[model samples]
Target: MAPYSVYVRAVRLALEEKGVAYRLDPVDVFAKDGPPASLLERQPFGRIPAFEHDGFRLYEAGAIERYVDEAFPGPALQPSAPRERARVNQLTSILDSYAYRTLVWDIYVERVSVPKQGRAPDEARIQTALPKAQLCLRAINDLMDDGPYLAGAALTLADLHAAPMFAYFTLAPEAEALLAEQPAIKAWWASMSRRPAVQATAYPA
Candidate 1:
């Protein structure tokens, strides 16, 4: 898995947070011809972060993260309380279903990555994504209400799940205004960004 992949970084953050030792075998899913055959062999669907542990194999970022948290002997990444655990799951689902596409692809990729790759950004796409992005942020912020973290009194998979996306999304200039509108999320990022796991898994420049 590449360090630049948000999904890969999410998994890595979980490993780092769990203090688990593991190897990250590189896979370029963005190869010119398409994803490498080796990746397809493990992931089947050509995702970047197919995982293996103790002879067990898994695909999909959420599944991998939960496995890492449960399989390892470390601080729990999931809350034990039913309501709190549900909140973690709910936030992760929102991030995966809505925020990932809007914040990462539509806004961050269009506004930041496109120019870096020597192509013009799709201004129309970014404009259209802004309201959607705001809705995602506000939804998350409302859920967070009076939090130092996303899922409540302690850090959980929810924070790890969202941090990687925020790491890329905040780089776009549009993020300044969009985040300013959601102070709870902005504050959450300010704290989450400083975690050792988050800093360690930072995208390479």
Candidate 2:
């Protein structure tokens, strides 16, 4: 929703993995009229995914994902081991802080969103952001283990957090070319894409 909001997609994937049924209330923060009062009330920052579950309100994709995993009954998305949980959090942070801006705002917005809006892509911005985005991918690949998942043998919040952004990244040819060089990341994305939960929540390509 909101034209490539990976943060929202992260929360949706977590909910799907937990088998929690929820309705989506889409918001266009860029609308001429701006966000509605209800959304602003829940998310004062005027962001895309402010969730409401059984009268409990939550914002921020990471917090929403943790709540979904803990509050619902299904396979655990978080690792129980302290070290593994820490690793999951570490990857999530990297995606949010380092990768998201360059990958989504700079690359995806320039290549996909701008073109859709009938504006030409800013080639200069894409060129500048590519190396930073590549560095983010390299960092993630280095943190990854030999296991099938990002944290360990099982799916964790890290995988969910990063998948949506990767999906968006794949939408742009330039970003896709850069991703092709990351074998570990490509393998991980393949595995994550096969998950039923991921398939269900995936944004249209």
Query: Lowest-scoring 10 consecutive residues by lDDT in candidate 1?
Result: 145-154
For candidate 2, give the lDDT.
Answer: 0.85
Candidate 2 C-alpha lDDT tens digits along 1-205: 4535788889989988888887887677777898888789989998878988889988999999999999999999998989999999999999989998999889988999899999999999999998999899888888887857777788899999988887888778886677688887888888888888778876663
Which runs in model 2 stand beyond 4 Å of their true positions? 1-4
Colliding pairs, model 2: none
- Which tens-of-lDDT digit does each residue in 1-205 have in candidate 1? 8989999999999999999998989878889999998999998889879999999999999999999999999999999889989999999999999999999999999999999999999999999999999999989988985788898778899999999999999999999999999888898999999988899888874
Deviation from native of the Cα of residue 100 in model 2, angstroms: 0.9
* Runs of candidate 1 exceeding 4 Å displacement: none
